[model samples]
Target: MPHAVKTFRPALGAGSVLLLVVAYLVVALNARFWGVVFDTTGLAGLHGAKVVAAVAAALFALTLLMLLPLSLRWTFRPGLAVVLLLSAAAAFFIGDYGAVIDRHALASVYATDAREAGEWLSLRMLAFIAAFGALPAALLWWVRIDWRSAPRELWSRLKLSALAFALLAVAAGVAGKDVASLLRNRMELRHIANPFALLAANLSYLDHARDADRPFVRIGTDARRGDVLVPSKRPVVLVLAIGESLRAASLDLNGYTRDTDVDLHPLPIVNFGRVDSCGTNTATSLPCMFSDLGRAAYDDAEAKHRENLVDVIQRAGYEVLWIDNNTGSKGLAARAKELSAAEGADPSRCNADGCHDEVLVDRLKTLLPTIRRDTVIVVHLLGSHGPAYHARYPAGFAVFQPECRTNELQTCSDAQLRNTYDNSVLYTTHVLAEIVSLLGEPSALVNRMPIEALRCRARRGHAGAGACPEPDVSPTAAVDPGIDAAMLFVSDHGESLGENGLYLHGAPYAIAPDEQTHVPMLLWASDRFAARRRLDLDCVRRGADRPLSHDHFFHSVLALADVRTAARKPALDLFAGCAPSR
Candidate 1:
């Protein structure tokens, strides 16, 4: 018979538990912070020692602010467990992804859907959570606490708090100057500090949530169509393709060494080589770019309450449709007919990582022939969203060799990551090419034109002898282009491909790298659309290299559809600079 094994359970007082958790958080969960500290201040001499002491004191002060107060019998273990898990998650994202847990980043996190969030789950992430979060939480739950008399416990806690404050004061006094200098020079350090950054983000979220029931302000209600001629006799159809996380520096059209835009090379696309994005991440940029308020005046908290460009265009008598292939359109499509790519996406183009951008192309192809009015279709593409870049495109589109196939970005080599990212961009270009072909060649569209378009043709007397031809649903059917269309492609923001130790976007706007803010913008319009809008392609091409930003997006899009309003700023319209001579 096996002898019964003796169980060993450790008992710790409330103060001791607090100390253990504080120590774990400061040491184990603060690797990214310590790494930054060492990088900024080496392990030698007086200045380094002063900085290290200051940072250590600051970390202790901040961590103790929460732990010291809650280190009581009823709240101690559960509180520590929450702190451990939260800090562990914060540490993982900060250390692995070089992500900052700030307001904008938290906003993106809140907006991310379950499918996109699943891309972040990996074996390493799970193991990290287990070792640092779950294991400590388990021990905290199992270990017995030695409770003292209420009066004694309160007195002991006060004494401990007094001691901690005294130590903190001493440390601050000794290294206050160095701390100030460090903080002034490296402000991002605060954002990388675990638990504090997370706490700060949550606090900001709470503050923003207070305005959840604020009154909605409608702008551009007085919007109307301008005196733009309709010489083409076909209704205008504009496709606004909002690209996701594509940097201008990586596009062949912008002089990138790789032929990422090879498929779009033959098209008469005006590539704005130097375009600044409103924000480094989608949550900030998507809404900001769509708002009438430019970058400097844009406030995320107040944006939802105000009407955006889409609403104004819709009010201007254009039928609006929003097709999202990525995440939902951040409430921009609330007033429009929104179609998700997943609803009718081709199974051949989908996988565990979700469907490729080709699904959007397929959706657009089917929607092209159905245009019967002045319409604006917004196509939100999942372009080059990381870290599973390898799954973003089809196998044939992965021309770059040796891709990083996993979502664990740190495990991949620089080349592998770049290859995978470039492949996604290439695939995006292919989708754009398919769209351009669909819009440029009217044969594909006119052959399958709806009966409504035929009726319009009959009304215009375009049908021979006033007898409209029955719609030919054949691919080889020859017919005049039935619609005047245009396409504008602009990435929501850019990405950081391991540049300067930053892997992905979401840096604060103040210190965001060029790679994270410089996005690609392209415009392609059919001959009829250009002529009707009085747009000169050659003139637009001459200013292709001019400096531009998302500030121009609102007015430019309005100009595309000739939507005029008191809110529309003519000075901000890029196409107006190339308007045809009267």
Candidate 2:
């Protein structure tokens, strides 16, 4: 008892410091991430304070639970450590910052006064002061015990738990502190692992521990497919070809000297300087971009079903045609033209020209003849799609000089990847141009149209090529009512391409990252489309300085397609008077 009294004071002293440091980092990391605090903003009154309290409550509880086995210091390891880190950040950002700040951007860019300095300064983003100040201090305060003498019962038991917590800190630092992703996984998978599995005599403890989230890809057996067949007014149309992993600053249409959109150079179009994607992947982007969650209001928990823009347009009495080359139906497309919606949706299959974009043109010829005056066909192009650049274009579309000659971008030189990737852009120009000629020709027979036999295509990440050609889009010839077209061209996401030691899409903390989310968006119109819609293409194309979220898609399509429904409305859509007729 005398020995215990002597050691308690210093032991409590260090424990107090440990608790404070943990609390500081937990709050600071998240607040900085959520963009809730500016460098100048004092953190005392932030919403993140509540998060800190909650985390502290949980930590205290965990510590109490851990007191059971502290002699060898076998304290909380996996669950507790992960929870502490995630809770700290999530509460800090979402609770405190709300949606006003871009925490991910600040986390990656703030320290350096180089590239993002000017733009980030506008929001007065200040995560740096929080991170540099909090992280080191917390990290240095590891739990320690100078046990010179003590009762065997208390010493052995509590020491184990203390050692456990220390080992945990080291493990976390090595793992790079990506706590948010781990929490998302928990939210995503609900089943608790069966502990009884450990009873198996030969079972590996590690395997049993990780048996919680199984069958990573759930097979959806009920896939219903059918072609979309609907009627509409004789609508002039514009089909925007979306590019994946494309940077807005790289587009020639955006005045990029790199000539990414080279083929479109001769057409009349204006490139907007600032545009951001609703989500970061084809899965996240396809649905979010065309939904009402343009600004991160997407709620999978509140989500019973995804009502996409195409659905609104079709209901508005416009013929909506969806052509896909990448991720199929991605929940959004599944809603429309599927057997469920079609009065008599076809077999949900179509063929095309060479392995490239000719598939879309070929599909269009059949559907275009059947479309009435007020029809809107969204021709989703397989433009500049990537990875195997060598296989995309036909024999000689290579205009940029020496070629990369191969695909697997990670294995090739950046220049080689750039060469091969740019060549794909060269083909994209030819394909889109041919698409323009075919769609523009009101006089030519659909069967006799030139794009029937077109060929080749390519995306992003550790798996792709990065180079692209921007379209010029100068003044072009008049557009016709029989086949009018407007275009909204954008990329689904951007890629790192081996930059800063990152080279893939779906990077963790991937709620929606700029590199993964920053995409090119161009709004171009044929003469007939501009005049008929009675729109100031310039103002609409300018897309307000106000940040646009992907959720506005439901409203945008409803407004542009002239479709009004109880589910969505004119006042709510993200856009007004978009292209491709819908």
Candidate 3:
């Protein structure tokens, strides 16, 4: 008889497998954590090694101890696979975009719609996940485990847990004070602690999810339409245009060297130069922007239970409408008339990636002629959101050459990123210009004005028949106005274009750079609206450089529409103290 063929099969003890996984997770999936550690501790000498070694030891022990509970015979491999996959996804964002895996960041992830999330899909991301997540998991599932009896396995796990605890104690004892100080100073490092950060974020999300069925609290219930101080026959209209990812530093109106705001150069829009966002991402900023609770007091869990700005304005008897081209209104429009531009988006303006912001202009065109009441139209734009910046605008809007079209932002050159981003900013301005021109049209106004003749009178400084000039406050320019309409544009948040190795937003708010917080805001009121409201255009211009924030948004819109409520704080309203123009 022929000798039986021998085959080799890899096998390891359960403890050995656990150790291998722990080591791999800490060392392989945590490049950002280690990089921050080395950067903060300075890898120059023995001191660096000491600090790094202590952190490594503590992290290792904590990870092993935490994971030990799930390292049983039936649960070990599956749990490990799950961890690897999650860690891989976290690592990709942390490494490539310099994003943190904190609760707010996780909230942004959870709130992201499929179209927005798909903007992040790329071959590089796929390859990274496959190499770091799926491959290891496949290998882990394939390996054979030398399992002992149940009692012996239980005792072995307990012994391993004990060992991990002892190691953790030793690590804490040796350099606890120094490590604590380091972490306190660099709190962001905590957010990059792989698996731990992910685990903590998920736990926080679950904790908040428990309140999903809680009773919804109502606010501004005393809201009612107040007597118009400067009465007019026509209805009041306020267009609240919430912009997305538009940094103040990138706009020409805010002194950007580029011509990103060229389209708005002729328009009489008040550019608030020193504006700050409440948060670095839309998930955090959107709710805070509309909530009565200011940024300092804004808690996602608490805010979800209360009514927002839209609900209050709607309750005040204004015909509130939310037209969304980005994502949904984040529950702000729960009680308002809502329209989605992306639902039946115009093919000329939309593609597989998403719809252009001009789709908003199209919606406004249809809705403009029909408004016959005091209205608050919220135009939520998908403005300059990345890393698919190139897809935001039309091909004609690609004036900036060599744009970065790929989702892999880090793969692009600095110029390409800025060019693509600037192009988007330009297109946004163009959209704003279009909206302004539309608002100035005779058909859109309640009482028809010779808007074309006015444009002609101001044509010395502008080219097109539709381009508007600066506010004509000349005594001779005064006349009785009919329609009361205005536009307020404020971004949800800002973006980071490879500044200080950060490619996207959603760093912890405390440590977020200016590029992620300093957003652009501007106001453009129709001539009649300004005149009827007795708005001191010059005074408004004088205060344009005031240090403003999202705190002003809620009260300002309310004040503009003459909505009176106990909840409205006059102190936070931007138009609070403007005297009537002479």
TM-score of each: 0.90, 0.51, 0.91
- lDDT at residue 317 of model 2 (Cα atoms): 49
- Where does candidate 2 stray beyond 4 Å? 1-166, 169-240, 300-304, 338-354, 441-481, 508-514, 541-554, 565-582
The digit string of per-residue lDDT tens for model 3 on 1-582 reads 999997666999998889899999999999989988888845468866777788999889878877898888778899999989888988999999898898888888889899999999999999999999999999889899999899988888888888888877776787777788889988998888998888888898778767787888899999887765333458777889999999999887776766677667667888889888999889899999999999999889888999999988888887889999988898889878888988776788998889999999888888877877778899999989899999998886676667898888888899899889988987787788777766762323211224333234323322233445544333233232334788999998899998988877998888999999999889998777877677777788898898999888888888877778999998888887783211
The models' CA-based lDDT, in order, is: 0.82, 0.44, 0.82
Q: Residue by residue across 345-462, what tens digits does model 2's lDDT show?
A: 2323221211455556556655655655555555554444444555555555564445555433444676666656666665665556556655663322222322212111122121
The whole-model C-alpha lDDT of candidate 1 against the native structure comes to: 0.82
Give the poorly placed runs of model 3, Cα more than 4 Å off: 1-7, 41-43, 229-233, 441-482, 579-582
Task: Name the weakest run of 10 consecutive residues (lDDT summed) in model 1.
Answer: 456-465
| Residue range 138-208, candidate 1, lDDT tens digits | 99999888889999888878877786787678778888777777777777888888887888888987777
Ranking by TM-score: 3, 1, 2
- How good is model 1 by TM-score? 0.90
